[model samples]
Target: MSDRVRLKGRFIKKKVRDKQVKAVAAMREAHLSKNVPRSPPNLKFSFDGRRIVDMQYLSEHLKCIKCKKDIFLRNTVEESRMGLNCILNISCEECSTLTRVHTGKMHGTGENKNRVDVNTKAVLGAVHSGIGETALNKLLVCLNVPPISANLYKRYEREIGPAIEAAAKDSCREAAKEEKQLVIANVDKLCQEM
Candidate 1:
């Protein structure tokens, strides 16, 4: 064969190999995505001595404060300067009741206050404990407060709060594993090409 013809054939072969690698990489990524678990909700909380203080993902059975029907209860955690607080919203499929629970810590003064007030730190703390950073940021934006950074948010996640941190960590680990699998698959394909 002529030199030029040989060179052309070699170039076409390389192009075909490259295309195959890309196709394989794309398929591997898709497979990884399918295997990956959905990211768990970051909202997590536990209860205080007598009250359901932390409201994130809490499941309880109670009489709906509004309709008075026995229903499953769920509370969302919210954040404020003082810490986390829970906002209880009870539902029975047909009706719902909303109530706010405070952790007693107040912002600015850091003093314990009457838990009945909505703006108290205890309430804010309960709210903060329940929601993840993304939700918290959205809530803060809605309330016209500055959004907290993710690093600061992580610190808050590690600090004194609900015992639901385990679920959050498991979620993060699962995501990381999915990402790592993608990386390894791509690397293996590249090595095969060489």
Candidate 2:
């Protein structure tokens, strides 16, 4: 079924290279040349914003766990935020696999679920500072960060408040025992001298 030409007593195959294909290839090359790789964003580390980063901004820099290829920000499925913790559910561009990436390391101390330690600490800081929810929210706003709601703060309060109190009580008891021991030793030395 080839396009052949008979000249004299021989057949010459027709050239398949067309101008349209060459034009298309040239256009493709030009388009590809325009898409130069961009340099990664310079991220500054801050105590308040240490673990959390904008996922969409860092998407191009992020590699897929499944294929070890690049993941695009456009394929983002969900951006879940819990106080200072953030988890991005994104799909891989090459493998189409879904992966969940956390903004900060999980605490692994929760009884039911593992959450970021920063969140618990944030709540603790608020409670310990006697600022409470409203004040904590104001501070976060001043820091230009998301606010931790009163409900979440209360949830953390219920979890860590008892522990904090118990720790303080134990520390006081230890200090009292040490002070009594010191007084007894001083008295014993004085008696020995007499």
Candidate 3:
């Protein structure tokens, strides 16, 4: 009887171990195949809490027109901000598509107030913080940074807003799923107290 019990215990332990190994293997496979959007780490440009964009911000943020892949930094040609009005030429590595993104232009005081050194990410961050476009421009100029035009700010917000919102929603859903068990337990405890 003792021998039989020991044999059964060993068998159960082996089975449990096998299941755990399988689960780990499956997780590794899923991680390898996960196709999350890849953003560059430690990107050089960021919102400084005062200005919306910076010089050379867009040069690091261009995507290939054909493949939609993030273009290599080396492929970006920094042009004359004054002469060309802040247009950057970028070549895509995957598809070799030459594309231009209007980053920002330097403007003389007498020149038309159209371009600022603001990038898309900075605009999005400002909008997310509930700051108005006009106020943001004012803040930038106050900080001695070039002011982004209202039209460009609005365009950036419109283009990138939905994607940001979607990502936020996904993050919230994931957080809620992780807390589901705790939430259920709390609800059950409340009901019992009631």
Candidate 4:
């Protein structure tokens, strides 16, 4: 190996040894888990949201936007309870995207300012089924999910709209072609009878 490589290896070895020494000293002074601060109980966030469990469970259902690959939630850096809301910063293993999901509770005010986590599947599914924004919003509100804004809904529609339209058009054309062929076959039999 070159001198630089040898020096780097030696430096890493020294750092590891120093860390081991520090850990031993810290353990002697106090317990490892006991010294760690506990997060407040009132925090609604349980990793993803109020309903979500660990990072593993959340990651299983989420995908990376850029790579279109399964995204894993890395280590939780910080978790804090600001009143009823839980502020969490979780890192992504695949893309290294830092996602912040804050579980917000309804304050004394009438409006909700918390960013609601909407399921992408639900939104896309409803849009595919030709559900309008107003109706969809009402349905979501009834189900206790925050209402999606019209502008945001339109933006989502714009993103996936062309693909959806093409698929629908293809299906319609196939159906029409089949119906025309069936009609022509029946008409030929009638003409032969005449």
Candidate 1 vs candidate 3, lDDT winner: 3
Backbone clashes in candidate 2 total: 0
lDDT of 3: 0.60
Best by TM-score: 2
lDDT per residue, candidate 4, 1-194, as tens digits? 42222343564455666777799999976876544444422323334333322344354445544445653334445565432234456544555544554433222223323322343344577786888888887776666545666776665555556777899999999999999999887997878889
Worst 10 residues of 3 by lDDT: 44-53
**Over the stretch 107-177, how does candidate 1's per-residue lDDT look in tens digits?**
33233232222233322464557756778767766765455567655644444344456667888999999
lDDT of 4: 0.54
Candidate 3: tens digits of C-alpha lDDT, residues 1-194: 22222243454455666777799999998897544433323334332233223456565557777678887646654432321135556666665556676655443233334434345556777877889888886776777666666776776676667888999999999999979967786997878888
- What tens digits encode model 2's per-residue C-alpha lDDT throughout 1-194? 77876655877655533544678899999988654543333323223343445455455446788678887655666666788676666677566666677665565554837755677888888778788888888887877777777778888888787889999999999999999999887997878889
TM-score of each prediction:
0.20, 0.57, 0.40, 0.41
Between candidates 1 and 3, name the one with more favorable TM-score. Answer: 3
Task: Provide the lowest-lDDT 10-residue window in model 4.
Answer: 106-115
Identify the runs in model 2 with alpha carbons over 4 angstroms from their true place: 1-65, 70-77, 108-111, 188-194
Q: Which ten residues in a row have the lowest lDDT in candidate 1?
A: 109-118
Task: Tell me how far the alpha carbon of residue 42 in candidate 2 is from the true structure, in angstroms, after superposition.
Answer: 24
Winner on TM-score between 2 and 4 is 2
Total clashing residue pairs per candidate? 15, 0, 1, 0
The parts of candidate 4 lying over 4 Å away from their true place are 1-120, 128-130, 192-194
The number of the candidate with the highest lDDT is 2
Ranking by TM-score: 2, 4, 3, 1
> After TM-score superposition, what is the CA distance of residue 93 in candidate 2 from its true location, in Å?
3.5
